[model samples]
Target: MRTAFFVDGYNLFYGLLAGTDYKWLDLPGLLAHVAHVQDPASHLVSVDYFTSGVKPELATRGIQSKEAQDTYVRALKAKGVQVHYGRHQLDPAKAPRFIDKQTRPSRQDKVDIWKLEEKETDVHIAVSMYRLAARQASLAEDGRIDQIVLVSADTDMTPALRAIREDFPAMQVGVILPHRAGIERPPPGSLKDYSHWMRRFITEDELLAHQFPARVPTRKKPAIKPEYW
Candidate 1:
């Protein structure tokens, strides 16, 4: 089976790597690990990673985080991961709202708080996936994709997955939920209801197994893992 992977960068980072030692990850290695575990026979054709650039002002580490993220993005591209960027938007005048899911409030309380939102990632992923499918749909049997692996737990992607399944019944669509190490973080049943299959991202053993080296030697510039990560 020929497969393509679509990764939601922020989703994976926050859900699995945040506050963990897996921040400096090898994208290709991680994808290989996923292929080995879930569908060992599938041949990986491409890896599309969607993410937003870090804002220096909003980040806790100021410019340091942005620099590190830039280096990481470069490294990913160097290693053959197709990096598609969205953007970060800062809304300082926006009010912060808190919602209690259990008890519905008529109007939630709002406080003045600076908000940093990552935008266009969901749309980018959806569009890219559909484009890939459409392009492959016209290709020869050997050149066409047999499966698409979406490495995200965001429920917003359900509609796109459903459309892909409906449009091309022969193509298999799967979801891999971003999960913490040793924790059970299953994808919502609603997403599973549309996908051909669903699985949790490998967090502990696979993360350690696929870690990037301390230094990545690139032709343009050598990339180093930030110490604070």
Candidate 2:
């Protein structure tokens, strides 16, 4: 079974790897482990990772995040993962204006802050999945891309998954929830409804096991894991 993987980088980070020491991940290695366990015969066609650059308006933290992200992206590209970029939009209107009762006294006005929302990543993932599925469907008779795997717990992808399943009934649509092993709940709504199979949750151990080296020596320069990461 030939397979292509679509990963929601933010979703995977916050859902599983955030606050963990596994931030420096090896995308292809993790997917290879997944493929080996799910279908040993599965041949990797491609891996599309969707994420947005950190918002520069965030100042110091943002700059640091961007540097770390850049290193990680380079590492992923070196390992043959296709990186897709989306823009980060700052929404000032959504920023909190009132002091939270839980954190502080209510007398003072809150600071003006920009909420960074990732734009077009979901659309990118959806379009890539659909386009790849369509192209592979044309060669389905030759046994190309037997499965399309989505690595997300976000329900927004449900529509695209449905479209792929409806448009090409022969190809299998699967989901891999990027969460811890014990919290096994699938995403609610159409995603769960459309998924033909749900792969196991990505484990903490797996993330630890499949990490890029601290110093990845690329041709141009060494891509090292950020000290803060």
Candidate 3:
């Protein structure tokens, strides 16, 4: 049996470690843990990670932590995070404007974060979901793809879930809430189809058990300072 997992990167990271000490939970490590939780009967058939790159303008205000984010994301790619870059839209109206003071003119409402939004993270997720569902349908038509696990809460995925249930009658769709283990689901209209929802939360202990701390493995401190001299 085969299975595919789709992840909303920002959604899972924010929700899971919002206030937890596991601020830097190991990305690759967590997926391994999830694979184990999903099924020991088979190796992770395919792991697909989807997310948009940080916006250009947010380079300052520490909005874009490309170094650290990339480090972690790189690890995932090495272990397998098929990242898909999304487009960033700029709304000039959002840029700061100010009235002149004297002389020529002066405007000082300087905000560097020009734009920020995953314009298509959800769309990418939906596409992947449907693709996997189609794969499952093909499998069902034959006989493969046992269990499908999705690590996301965004209701946009509801339709994909619906299609899987309706089309691939043989596959099992499992929803894993890395953070919203116990939170309430979105109200009715918000989620198109959730009648067949099967939910479960990832326990804190589980997260702790998978911490892949971000730290340099080998680094030595300076010998000593000569301020006294």
lDDT of 1 by residue, 121-179 (tens): 99999988888888885788988889898988898898899899889788888888878
lDDT of each: 0.84, 0.83, 0.60
lDDT of 1: 0.84
Which model is ahead, 1 or 3, in terms of lDDT? 1
Q: Which of 1 and 3 is ahead in TM-score?
A: 1
| Each model's total of backbone clashes | 0, 0, 2
After superposition, candidate 3 runs with Cα above 4 Å error: 28-43, 56-64, 92-115, 136-143, 180-197, 213-229
Q: Rank the candidate models, highest lDDT first.
A: 1, 2, 3
Better of 1 and 2 by lDDT: 1
Check candidate 1 and list the clashing pairs.
none
lDDT of 1 at 30: 79
lDDT assessment of candidate 3: 0.60
Best by lDDT: 1
lDDT of 2 by residue, 1-229 (tens): 8788999999988888878888998888888788778878877778999998876557467778878888898888877889999988877743335545776533344566657778999999999999887887466366678888999989999899999988989888878888877776745656778987776578778888998889987767989999977
Runs of candidate 1 with Cα error greater than 4 angstroms are: 93-109
